[model samples]
Target: MINFTLDQWYGWINAFLWPFARLLAMFSVAPVFGESTAPSIPKVGLAAVIAMVVAPTLPPFPALATSSYEGLLVLAQQVFIGMALGFVIRICFSAVQTAGDFVGLQMGLSLATLYDPSTHSNTEVLARLFNILAMLVFLVFNGHLLMLDVLIRSFTALPIGHASLNPAAWMGLAELGGKIFSSGLLLALPLIAALLTLNISLGILNRAAPQLSAFSVGFPIMLISGVLLLTVVLPHTPSYLNEFYQEMLGHMARIADTFAAPRGGAN
Candidate 1:
């Protein structure tokens, strides 16, 4: 008969629980998995499945303590690491939404808000539309799988209890945040520039004929031009989204490297 001591059982359970808790925390805030619309039971089940697959591949943990407090601390650490990784991807998606919001504002559609089920908040219609489009493109480009692969590889690169948020990593994440504005501005530039020229022309026309109400005439013109510009720009959006996704992946990889690197060296 196999003889397992109490300590041995505690160790076994701790080993499993550590990674499981971490994976659960990760999925809890991850993009699709974290969405408000996702059913909780399924999300928890998925986390368990992931933890089981990944636990054996993880680095060995220190001897488990019988105290529940130690286990909770371990669980908290894992949750933090998972949340940081998931947040990086979430920021990337925010870039697309940011661009959409800007476009909506420029096109005078800022007031058109819709209920976003995923977030359970009201967001600009254009932002929601672009977010959906970006998601589809993300799937088409195999980005979802790539992200999962990255998350898995992160364990090997920056193993649990080994990872730390370095200054360089924080700087890189900050830089990544800046890209949201840059990408959004880039996506909205054409429309903005076109509108500027159209408004200037309308101003000149109004000056030449005071009888014409610029509000009436220019409003429709602006709307039509904006719609036309969007139609023309629609085909190019996938390319932009693809580039954004690639950049996000690269940024995440760099962050992982920073975390994996020796502490207090060049970032």
Candidate 2:
């Protein structure tokens, strides 16, 4: 039987360690897995399991060893790469949340914030509804599968030890952020215009009858009108969610391109 020396065994274990560490780092900070609501023990366990599965499929280990500072640098780079990918997806989801917040504020539902167990932050009621709907739609459309596919493809496109950020890619991510305002405004436009009309009408009524309590009269009417408008627009939400997922996948593809580009090449 073939025999391995102590140094050879150490080298073999080290070879797996770096790749495993990189994968763990990626999963640790990546959006869904990185959320604060996720238990630390489970997250660590899942990361280890994923690393075990993915490490063998990856390219050969880089020359860097865990014993050196360079290994730590590589670990950091891997984590950054994974986090950047997850962040892009997170930003896309935030567009819907932003739109919901704008709609809630315009509709006088600003005080209706609720604790979101997923994100562990208080979110507008409308935003929570939309976010939950978006997640459901994402699963319904197999977007989660697509996301996993992209992550797997990343291994080949941007192998281990090949982490580097592209400026153009970053600019693209910034542009994605800019879409939030546009999309949010678009989603809120109809409601905003209707509210403005109601406000103007109330103003006229107030001017005509000083004895009338505008606040008392206007609040219920506005609330009812907002509810009716939301009902009317509810049917369109699925279409918007579908579009958002499509855009998200496209952005992920762009990120892949950015990560896959040569060190000095354009994304």
Q: Go through the candidates in order and give the C-alpha RMSD of each one to the true structure.
A: 2.1, 3.0
Native-referenced Cα lDDT, model 1? 0.78
Q: State the displacement of the C-alpha of residue 217, model 2, in Å, after optimal TM-score superposition.
A: 1.7
Q: What does candidate 1's lDDT look like per residue over 1-267, in tens digits? A: 999998888878776777777677767776676777889999889878877888887887767574667666666777776777677777766887888898888777899899998878999998998888887898899987787778778877777666455657766667777877888788778877887888899999999999999988887788788889989988898988888888787777777778677778736
Q: Model 2 over residues 1-267: C-alpha lDDT tens digits? A: 999876676457655665556555655554456566779888778667766777777777676556678767776766766766666667656777787888788678889999987777899998888677766777788876676667666777777666565667766767777777777677667777888798789989999999998989988888888889888987777787778777777787678678668666864
Question: Which stretches of candidate 2 lie above 4 Å from their native place?
Answer: 1-31, 117-120, 205-211
Q: What's the CA RMSD of model 2 in angstroms?
A: 3.0
Estimated TM-score per prediction?
Answer: 0.90, 0.83
Indicate which candidate wins on lDDT. Answer: 1
* Pairs of colliding residues, candidate 1: none
In model 1, the runs with Cα more than 4 Å from the true position are 66-70, 163-167
